[model samples]
Target: MQPSHTPHVLVVMGVAGTGKTTIGPLLAARLGVPYAEGDDFHPQANIAKMSAGTPLTDDDRAPWLDAIGRWAHDRAGLGGVVSCSALKRGYRDRLRAAAPGVAFVHLTGDRELIEDRMAHRKGHFMPTALLDSQFATLQPLAADEAGVEVDVSGDPTEITERAVAALAHLAPPQ
Candidate 1:
């Protein structure tokens, strides 16, 4: 188990296939917090749109982001991890507005690698063709954002270790 630290939520974010769903629960387990799958917050209509290979417009995403924001806000100081494709600055901003202290873990990787991973993954609605749109929409965390950028180059354990290490400073005193 991890040593005691402050209770703070983590939003594991990145484009599809970056392993947010896989690594988020691992991070939460290590930190001894609950895990929320962000995809679950999407309305069926949103899923249908994605399933049709249509990228969601900002208007289409508003309610979904708000829902995730509410979840994050509710978990404040209770310590939780949630997976979100927080791909845009505006999206991240909406989350921050809802939960001011929520920290992000932006997973990054090469596009080709991500495409291959997506192609092989089963039972996911996000089509591989949309990866380009996600990349286009992604605005890397600004220097002032409260988060870390972990490269998605290794196994999940190694990546989690890196994320944990990177977030060490954010942890409160025991």
Candidate 2:
């Protein structure tokens, strides 16, 4: 399918280790758009909190979420994809406020698989110990949300293909 003219801002969203980082770029490439890694927008304090195994309060997350939201708005203006762990309804709402037409692609999987992925992963601030809290905080996207949910337990390429195809359907005709 050809790229759409609509402001195709896709947020690759989920709890940690759900392949947002892996699939986001590929999805962007498939759509011929740029991509942003949401983690880069987090403040050092927030990173430290997660690294220290403490969950961030909404107060702590608001600024970080706003930063990501602003980035999404900017990119949506130019049409792009973004990887974000927008774990709560409020967070997603904030993102929507910034980018009105933004769509989310939620990657979900079994907790065991996600925990295993987190345990073996490296150089990320969020620890596996925090997985439970992450899951606790996660308010999965509602059915009416403007996006698709893809099971990410399979191969990365397959997950990317699924996300790409889903986004393709949502994208406006070229």
Candidate 3:
């Protein structure tokens, strides 16, 4: 695609502690768009389940995903960023259905690295105990998905920079 200044929605996606919360706002700021934290849209039941070290089922996450999708859909025309675990392809598809043309930036890293980060994290509902479940459910962006996968081995600033640079040329699935 030719260079353009059009604004777009970008889903900063990954499991917990991959820096979705840390990097999403930064990416949005760099893009000059509004940002939303996907966690804020989670229903209390979903939070309770995760907080209890329970892996949320697809049934438990439907509304939460819908809410985040709605937020993205509302801001799609002018561009925005939102951070979501979006572990499953179906979940991402739900978000995409609500807001077509939105792109994704998947933060990925080694399991040990992610678990270490999760273990040291505080004040988050997600427990490190459920990380394996998260990983099991995670579906990397498919060939038909519009996205880029950025390794989380770098510093947050560098990761954000990489996301911005990648988005410049990334194309949405047709």
- What do the candidate models score in CA lDDT, each in turn? 0.91, 0.85, 0.86
lDDT of 2: 0.85
Best by lDDT: 1
By TM-score, who's the top model here?
1
lDDT of 1 by residue, 18-122 (tens): 999999999999889999999999999999999999999999899999999999899887879999999998999999999888889999999999999999999
Each candidate structure's TM-score, on Cα atoms with residue i matched to residue i, is 0.95, 0.93, 0.94
Q: Model 1 Cα displacement at 94 (Å)? A: 0.4
Tell me the lDDT of model 2 at 2.
54
| Comparing 1 and 3 on lDDT, the stronger one | 1
Ranking by TM-score: 1, 3, 2
lDDT score of residue 145 within candidate 1 = 81
Candidate 2, 52-170: lDDT as tens digits: 99999999989988988898778765788888888898999998998887889999999999999988888888888888888999999897678888999788889988887777667
lDDT of 3 at 75: 84
